[model samples]
Each structure stands twice: as structure tokens, then as C-alpha cells.
Target: MMKYLWLGLIFSMAAFRVMAFPAQGGCKLAQQHQITGKVGRAIHNAAQAHVVVRANMLEASLSNAVQAGVLSYQQGHKQWLEVHSVRQQALAYKQGITSHELKQFDHKLDRVTLYLCRH
Candidate 1:
């Protein structure tokens, strides 16, 4: 009777261990990090695109205001010009174009977008 009880206890412990084993491909930490990295980058890019579009629209409205004399000539116009330049840069970056024997402009665009999101 004593031997049978010991064997049953050992079998039960082994079964419990098997049932409690971790899932396949251990190291959940690394997988989680990778998931976070991808999500962060995607969020940053989306944010950059959204902000750039809003800024561009504002610049366009300012230009329209200048034509209609709703805003002073230089004030809103200057702001619009600046935003236009930034929008151009962003568009070029989005296009992934290279110029003047340099690396693609998209690289800088991606960096800027990421920076904006981080801030």
C-alpha cells in the first residue's frame, strides 16, 4: 500500500509539470519587444502623415486668405510658405526619392516623422 501511494504521488507531480509547461517558442519578452517596436514605428509614421496633411491644409487656407485679403500680405503668407516647404520635404520623403548624389530623401523624412511622434 505504501509503495502504490508513492508511485501515484510521483505520477501526479509529473502530470502537473507537463500541464504547466510554457507555450512553444519560449522567451516571450523578445517577441513582445519586437511587437512594440513595429507598433511604435507604425504609429509614428501615421502621426507624421496626419500632422503634415493638417499643416498643409492650414497653409492652403492661409494662402486663400491672403488672396481674399482676410490676412495681411506678409504675415499669413510667410507662415504658409514655410509650411509649404515643409510639406514639400515631407512629400519628397514619402516618395523615397534621391537627389544630388545623396541618400534617398525618404530616409530623412522617416526620421523626422519618428521624431515628431516621439515628441
Candidate 2:
């Protein structure tokens, strides 16, 4: 009985930590909402709102990088360089680009674009 009790307590604590994990998994559901919601509907508006909210999320990740001196100006420049290169490549491949690949490329460019706009 005591062994089972101890195991239960350990499991509870582990479960708590697992549940506290960050929101990477959250994005899939959010994206689903964005896709299915009507263009001018309230859920659609909320989906759009998520975009702005997610942008600030970078503050936490980027601040940590900056504080650790990991996100140098050169790194930012490199990001911009990659964005340009990807954009040109994406355009050249426009005819063959699948929606999934295009969306992924756009996501990368969007991140760099936001970083550039803010800095």
C-alpha cells in the first residue's frame, strides 16, 4: 500500500511538469481554428488575434538568446540574408512549390521579417 502511495505521488508530480510544458503543441489547434473559421466571424477574428499574440512570444526566446549574447547582430543579418535567399528561391520554384513547402518557407520569412521590423 505504501509503495503504491509513493508511486502515485511521484506520478502526480511528473504529470504536473508534463502539463506545464510550453505551447508548441498549442499551435496546431490554433492553426486549425484559423483555417476552419469563417473569414469575418468571431472565431476567425480570434484566430487572427493569435498572430499578434504569438509575435510577442519571441520576446522570451529572443531575450534569453540576447542575454546569453547568442542573438548577435550578425546572426540577425544572417537571418535577413536567409530570408532574401529563400524568397528568391521560392519565387524561382513558384511553379513547382507545393502549398506545404510554400507555407513553411513563408513562416521562415515571416519570422525574419518580424525580427527585422522590431529591431
Which has the greatest lDDT? 2
Clashing pairs in 2: none
C-alpha lDDT of all candidate models, in order: 0.42, 0.45
Provide the lowest-lDDT 10-residue window in model 2.
35-44
Model 2 per-residue lDDT at 51: 33
lDDT score of residue 20 within candidate 2:
32
Measured against the true structure, the TM-scores of the candidates, in listed sequence, are 0.34, 0.32
Question: Model 1 over residues 19-84: C-alpha lDDT tens digits?
Answer: 331232112323311221111322235334543544444455555445544457776656666566
lDDT of 1 at 27: 22
Model 1, position 23, has a per-residue lDDT of: 31
Instruction: Check candidate 1 and list the clashing pairs.
Output: none
Q: Which portions of model 1 show Cα errors greater than 4 Å? A: 1-44, 89-119
**What does each candidate score in C-alpha RMSD?**
22.8, 12.2
Question: RMSD, model 2, all Cα superposed?
Answer: 12.2
- Could you give me the TM-score of model 2 versus the true structure? 0.32
